[model samples]
Target: EVMKQPGTNVIEVADAVLAVLPDLQAQLPPSVHLVIKDDNSVNIRKAFGDIRVTMLVTLVLVVGVIYLFLHNASATLIPALALPFSILGAFTVMRVMHYSLNNLSMMALILSVGFVVDDAIVMLENTVRHMEAGESPLEATLNGSREIAFTIVTMTVSLAAVFIPILFMGGILGRLFREFAVTIVSTVLISGVVSITLTPMLCSRFLRVVHAKKGLAGFMDRSFDRLRSGYGRSLRLVLRHRLAMLAVFVGVLYATVKMFGIVPKGFIPNSDNDSLRVQLRAAQGTSYYEMVGYTQRIADLIKQNPDVDSQMANTGGGSGNQNTGRFAIQLTPRATRALTAQQIAQQLRGPLGRFPGFRAFVNVPAALQIGGFRGNSSFNLTVQSLNYDELYAWAPRLEQAIAELPEVEDVSNDMELKSPRVNLIVDRDGGRTWPPQKCQALEGRALRVA
Candidate 1:
């Protein structure tokens, strides 16, 4: 019944609510029942599943590709081990920093998988090359790591430097990107540490001396050698024809810059969260039942949508405004539905748009509903003047102008001043003469009617 405060954890709130459910139910009459439903837990579980699945798929692919190239189980295992150690270490750092493993952070972790394994792969390959050149395992490990240590450190620092600025960005965007950027930087640094230390140690302990290869392993080795030679030849050719290469590079860069204007731009991308809200506002003088009727019609039409899982409506005193009500439509989970919450809201708009004597808006809630950015609608316009008469006079005309724009929909104004009210004034002498019981009775009746 109450809107959650900004930045409050929905899951924790739901848990606190459930913890006191037994006492609440006991205090209520037998005919009354409390049913608690929430999507936070479902959302959390889905986020975890998505992160797990994405990491697992990346792990499998990386392992497969490594095994295919190396053809040695021990060599592949060395680099693969970096994945778990780097991720676990990043998680530990995140705990220390009080970061939650939400969707954005998890995505950052997934992306870091590619970068994390790079240092390990480079060190392992270099060490293997030393071993193939007839050095002892310990000597190969030491020499190989020593040679690549600076390179790995530089790469890690460079990657971290790219994201560090994002942490200092201002406002909501800064908050959102800070977690993602820091997570990547932390994971990459951890991966670099594990690469130079654990990776070489494991290679020295478990890696075997290379022997003459045949079949698929030999073919892969020869193919890689050919690719390396070809790349070297191409590099030489490009260096020899510097002028032609420069022209081609400049032309490609210019084309890419020109294409930037064709890309769609927005502050934030739309997310499919499987929930929609419908705000209903009746005419200023509309009664509570009349508003309830309008809300019911809208809810009924929304229920007809196959993607809708459940819905709740509020009217009368529960609604925020006297002539306003709200409907919360919970759609089926994203996996079970093809349409996004925004699309479903658009579909329901047709029915709600036809409702008589009511203005309704259907929208998905914002990811973070901060001050002046409720996300209930696309845009908000405020008309302020020192004189109430001038403000009210111009507000409707402005609202109508905005509503007439081709891109605007569900336009509404909260400036209506025509609501009917009855003010009761009791004469001091008349009330002094009235009996206490009569005054009490009148007050009780007014309260009941209200």
Candidate 2:
């Protein structure tokens, strides 16, 4: 059965037992890769099949890169062979320690790619050199590998030691990044093992002396000789003209300092993508209806036609009465969506100029991600002051001062002002417990301000 709906092809799974064949029986169209895996209850095995595909793609890509550079099939195969063992070791350790394969864990594997392959290449190159020389295959493999074993171990331990600080670092961010650190160190150590043992074994079985092109090899040797001679001559010239070189060096250093002084200094560097994060900070006691109206007016332009996939506008003060709300919007997928996420954000920002008594901020993803991170960052300001009134009045002025600068944008003031709210009154004698008195006056400038 087939139904071509551009992004969907209906599969007739009639009378088929999912338990018998847990994977998709029909080939999926490439146009719809992001299949909705909502039926986790029926048979979640389909999810693992997707995971397997992801892992296989990772393996193949790594293998291809190795094969391209090293010019040896065995060099590629060694890591590919050892990766499963490495993953098994990693997974077993994680399982014992109760770690799940999620964003941070998967992030670790991605970060491990460079380090994991480094050790393998080093060991293989060393072993290949021995084979090319007069040494017999087994003798060269053993002795050549032994010479590099200490170096490999030292390098691995050194890399692992650097990661220790990240593990010991305090805070929620540290905890999250710790997973990435663990992944890197684990994969490096595993690669060292594969390098010393499995790499040499593979080299003993498969690596051979390949013929170097005569013109290229000759040019390389001559280039090295020239480079060596050039370095010696340059070093002699520098030593002979030490005083002049020192004067020039000091002048250069001073110029660098001057250049640095002129360079703009700030808390964080600006980013390339122009993602305008238009956040609304309304006055106190603002109704949920008011909030929803503002959000809907803003989101109305977003949700029309075809660009938006889904948007979640939190339409009330959270249960905490924080009087704040947020939205997480996902644009339509890459293949169809014409506008970049930033472009959509800019579209929202442009309409905001038409509104009054509201503040909107244009920000980059870097600014949003790092600023929104669970830390005491983003809106950091320092002011030398004595009085609370001074703080309230001067803060907005300071914000204005900063906002007026070409570099600064979307400045805001905190809770110095508020919206008027309904106040319940009760007087038991007149069917209420209280009355407006001079001590607690409920009229005019004072009550309205409060």
Candidate 3:
């Protein structure tokens, strides 16, 4: 069984295993056949593709929003150009830092889209305002950039500073989000530079003053004028009632604190990846064939579910004993299925309960599968003690208590305290006095008993 080291990359480990397969196969006896029943790299690749597509969609949507507000192709294009430049600079930083384009980094990239465009948008709007006041594009670019340069620098530094705490966070969260923090910070810094440099240059070259708007542009301008005036009136009224606004702000702050305490906390949120992990366990000391029978029975029931696309069941592999089996169940695409993997697993609990002396655990595979984690479910708890008797005695009570909680389900432990055991003791003096043949005979019997 191959197990990954904690903090190591899953894809890199899988690739290393695959790279040696051909040589390993050649060394094996002709009678032995090698088969790969599961490969996580395939799913990782699929997720990467999906995330890339989502990032592209986010870019397009961000650009569309910019165009809708700006109403001029040249004005919109300046920020659009800045976005890619900022991203490229961020990629360079990622390469330098030896960071992989994993989920967290990709998420940072998606979030950075808005931050990257903001700098350029600010520069473009201010420059266009100068152009509307009858200054030439070159003169407008020079004066507008000079005015906004300090603000851009301050905004960039403040935004990056917000993530500084995340960069220094301790434990697994710190390791995971360090990349996220760095990516956004680098992107923001790059966008700031681009805004102060390339943005003004582009505006000077591409921007043209338009004194009048027509059609959709004219309607949008009129609507924005009304909105700005209404907003001004509301702002003035709120400023006049300073005490009321301060009370409202304090109320919001208190509510935010309360909400933070009330919300459930987790390192990573669950995702529906259209797959489920079904773990089958029989009572300890159960034979491998008996476990196989239980596995097949569960597999048959799982096959009856229309949502299940395919499933593979196996017994006695990896760290599992003869009494344990597992099923890697693939579900149909999310769009075609009415029930999510978690919901289907919950529903299956009823039918799975019909089997006596067997426990079937169903769970969706975590979107972020941390290396070195060996748990049937997303949450794992370990109880450690030097005293075996005390540890075993306490485990069941803890498990039962946890199972009773409304938030927990399918609570189980690996302790096999019910397994039959035999204790053997021998008297040294008695064994020394025994004849050789008799001692040999006793040893043979002990082996048979074992």
Candidate 4:
């Protein structure tokens, strides 16, 4: 039986099933077997786990660096508090706006970790500077926050300006990124508010003065001071040699342009996931059992790889043709496997390419499948002609030419013209004069031929 949860996510539904799967399997007959044909829940769970790990690691590293520079655990903790507050607050807003906790939003939250802590760190640093100058914590908190309040606001607005345009982009790209951009902008704005309000309050209550000691932290601080001084001196030198600086800037710009032109580009980065969709097509006149046999052989070949967890083959539904079939290959989760779905697909392609009388294409599903974007393959070219014969004649040559391109791989055309047809002709006057049974016999013969 198939079931769906109306208001719950696929991950939740899968978890609910897993909780009872063992018991359910135990009650089944020894000869019967149960298999999940396709489960997107695993992908969702893995992606969420990865995002969580990324956020946690980022927070730890950020806090550790802050403590190293400030040499005070209390000061480090002040900025660290902003990370969760901003993220949780963003979640609250997301819930109210009806956004789910999907990969794009999770990625945005992870990326926002850097920006979310920036305002808090800046405010804390400024407050520490005033404390070092011998001001009381409360006074330093008020004055330091007041000093950088405008700066934080300006930073938030500038970041928002950059991401807000993405919300207005039309089509699949826009739909995929709109949630990501909104999550970032919202978290940054929340962080700004926290920096000026909660951050200063925490600093005033918890921040304390620390005396310098002879250690690695003190040595690093002294080195940083020297670096800042040298940078100031360089700035003054550049101001004095404006023409030389301009020439150097132009040379750097030219180098940047040339480097950009040399870099390879693609529509989307291939995700290293654990599932692949292998589409197979046999010759037009192939029998149903022959197609199934071919698909079973392909499945057997796929199962030879240790990473493969399961395989499901579906025949006779592809483009309404009996010769076409598809294999849904599931592999072990990415953490437990060394090869990605795409890599495994490539490895299998070598053997499948040698399979006689059949053509195969492999692709991983798209990360986000939106309207008009089927996401089944990497690229698609649509050919249209008013004349059917001309279209049929031109399509094969175009397909072959594209297949021969050095950069292209697994090229195939959707236009199939192998179905047999029969034309029926009758003398209208004589047929009208004939008995109805005679006309029926002629129609049956035409249908049999067709």
- The local distance difference test score of each candidate is 0.84, 0.63, 0.87, 0.84
Query: Which candidate tops lDDT?
Result: 3
Against the true structure, candidate 3 has what lDDT? Answer: 0.87
lDDT of 1 at 140: 94
Q: Which stretches of candidate 1 lie over 4 Å from their true place?
A: 2-9, 19-30, 317-319, 372-405, 417-450
> What is candidate 2's lDDT per residue for 172-275, written digit by digit as tens?
66867787677767777887788788878877877666546355445665776899999999999999999999999999999999999998886435432312
Look at candidate 2 and tell me the lDDT of residue 219: 66
Selected candidate, larger TM-score, 1 vs 3: 3
Best by TM-score: 4
List model 3 lDDT by residue over 1-450, tens digit each. Answer: 588896799899999999999999999999997776566677778788889999999999999999888888888898999988999999999999999898789989999999999989999999999999989999999999999999999998999899888988988778778999999889989999999999999999998756798988889899999999999999999999999999999999999999999998886777887888888778888987788788889988999999988888889756687788888888887789898878998988889978998888888888776676566667888899999899988999999999999988888888878876888776898879898988787774535444
RMSD over all Cα atoms, model 4: 3.5
Least accurate 10 contiguous residues by lDDT in model 3: 441-450
Clashes (backbone N, CA, C under 3 Å), per candidate, total 0, 7, 0, 0
Q: 351 in model 2: Cα distance from truth in Å?
A: 2.1
Error of 4 at 11 (Å): 0.6
RMSD of 1: 5.8
The candidates, ranked best first by lDDT, are: 3, 4, 1, 2
lDDT of 4 by residue, 328-429 (tens): 787887889877888887898898889998988888866654446332356777788999999999999998998899997888877768778767785678
Backbone clashes (count) for model 3: 0
- What lDDT score goes with residue 314 in model 1? 89
The best-first sequence of candidates by TM-score reads 4, 3, 1, 2
lDDT of 4: 0.84
Better of 2 and 3 by lDDT: 3
